[model samples]
Target chain A: MLAFLLDPAALSGPADGASDMHPTRQRLISVATRLFQQRGYHAIGLAEILALSETPKGSLYHHFPGGKPELAEACVTRIAESSLAAIDRLSGSGLDMIGFLRRLAEVTAAWLQRTDWLDGSLLAVIGQEQGGVNGPLSEAVRIAYQRIEMRLARWLMAEGVAVARARDMAATIIAAQEGALVLARSRHDAAPVTLVTDMLCTMVDRG
Target chain B: MLAFLLDPAALSGPADGASDMHPTRQRLISVATRLFQQRGYHAIGLAEILALSETPKGSLYHHFPGGKPELAEACVTRIAESSLAAIDRLSGSGLDMIGFLRRLAEVTAAWLQRTDWLDGSLLAVIGQEQGGVNGPLSEAVRIAYQRIEMRLARWLMAEGVAVARARDMAATIIAAQEGALVLARSRHDAAPVTLVTDMLCTMVDRG
Candidate 1:
């Protein structure tokens, strides 16, 4: 669980005005998304996000319109786009399932270190805290997960894994990756993420 | 990533007044632990905890003089003690590492179902939300994870795994389990958890 890639990459979704969005609006969403990822929805306030982004409160209302949840929805959209792009970028390359996962481990570890462990998967933080309760956010979270899983499953199926097995493998991989991020952040170490990938790759090699 | 088992099982630790504590206090801790596990530390409030537990405000203050965080610390303590006991109980049985992991998956899945997907790892929810920011809470979360990792590593070492490899495997398993809980809860399905354990067990069995 890391922040979304800003490049947006070559994926199959609308860009959502991210490139052309107002600078102030983009700053608010970026700041809010990171804060929400770190401290969660209930803990952080809009004032802090506004002050951190150096944007006035009126512009926030003007851009987000629906305030916090609305902004969070944008965060979800941005995250989903960025994350899917990341997956696409990795999978489309010459990486198999294990290679794709190993690369993910490296990227996530670097991200954690670069951010000083302050950032994690926004969808994960939101999903765990507000998973079933936060309506639109929760729905987005579910869809994002499903999309990521489907992509991973497709990768597995390409390797001749049965459809059911591929789906299960994808689900398990995602769970471990997300869970590893939490553990790594909590322990202030990235070994957990790398370890899981290593173990999985080793197992696959053995088979 | 589930609530603490109440029986406390056999292990070493101060009982911490759980058994003979005032019913009101016990109820407060129990209610607070479950709520914190579900909605996270910041999302749920003292008033809501009190209302859910049906305890008077006076009783709440009398038990936890330090208030919300204090109660949360108690919840953490209770959970830590409970989780350690769960580990001890599982490992001390005749189950090997694979069986131990398999049993854990089943229990976690059932816990998810029994709780209607609301409950998950308390330390995980709190750790992600307040991991680095909340001082005492963060410290407790780190220790809890370390203790669990050590226990799992010991189990692996018992299987003749080398020290470093066992440690990585332990760390990876914990990360996956915790992450699986988040995914399972988000999707309101326990298959993610069961799927992870099954994959790990199959890999182990194959080896």
Candidate 2:
């Protein structure tokens, strides 16, 4: 897995020790993110993360002090940011808005296809895994979903739609996509994902 | 854990069994459904189900020849049937169409609330649980979701809506409610479920 980081210091730098991205941190995040995304947060353990990441037990705490919960927070935040960035990139390509969404759907389909039809959202899997009774993980999920909705809402507003209507529609679209992903994962197929995107684009055109 | 199956003996009654439901069979389904809902499918074991339901070990195989997968299938089927029956009862009450949907939402909300703010859809939980590659559970999930969508579509069409449009809307509403349940479960709150229901009702009214 690539080194996914919020800061470049987590990359490679000299002068300050803080400027250097430790290998262990990168390894931990990459492995934990994948496992949690695949099997769910509650179903994964630190030992498995360590073994997959090829990192030592001693340095796990150096990166995440709060343990799995902290790791989960980091993963959720990272994925949320990455998703927003991907949406921004899709929108920036100057494609028509609906076409942009379709392209987004296709790219998502390709990614899931590569993962052998595994569900990729860690927060989503965790929410189901823990069943929302746990506080921190549940909060992570709420914020992550809200972030996606907010980003989509912003896009809708940019298209000169009504704010309230755009917000509701954005939430609906997000829910549809998430639900479609669940369907895709359950059936181990990407057709539902693409079909939903088509349906959403059709709805947008109808409006 | 109330009896999930309205009639478990139906499975055997087709052959050479009593016409009435068996006590151990009902107990097994009831406990297994609750456990599968509260904990996950794989996380709960046959021993745990037997212990909780107080059904003897021998009776489990007697009731479910295919073991956990068979038991899970039975639970999913029963929950789906019960939910459809409830919706039918509500819609058949001779209320206005919108009034019927509202009541349906209320009943759904009440059930969700009583479950301590947990997402109570056995089908949705099972779908997520069986999100594996090419498993029997995955196939069961697809059938369960399809069953839900078809039933909802039938209801909408019977209310004098266009067939294609009703099916589309049914798919959307089912996806939305399932998504909202994910939110509600993660937040451990009923507000999201109610919000989604209100949104659905609004959309149905406009349509």
Best by DockQ: 1
Give per-residue CA lDDT, model 1, range A1-207, as digits (tens).
433333212112353436777778777877887788878888899889989989988998998789898998888777776766666667678787677777778877877787777776777888878845848878888888888788777877887788987787778778888888898889899888887787667645543
Docking class of 2: acceptable
**Which is the leading candidate under TM-score?**
1
Q: What DockQ was computed for model 1?
A: 0.69
The DockQ values of the predictions, listed in order, are: 0.69, 0.34
User: Per-residue lDDT tens digits of candidate 1, residues B119-161?
Assistant: 7788888888884574888888888888877876787788778
What candidate 1 gets wrong by more than 4 Å, as runs, is A2-17, A203-207, B2-17, B203-207
Report the error of model 2 at residue B149, Å: 2.7
Q: Cα RMSD to native, each candidate? A: 3.6, 6.3
Looking at model 1, the pairs that clash are A1-A121, A179-B179
Give the per-prediction TM-score of chain B: 0.86, 0.84
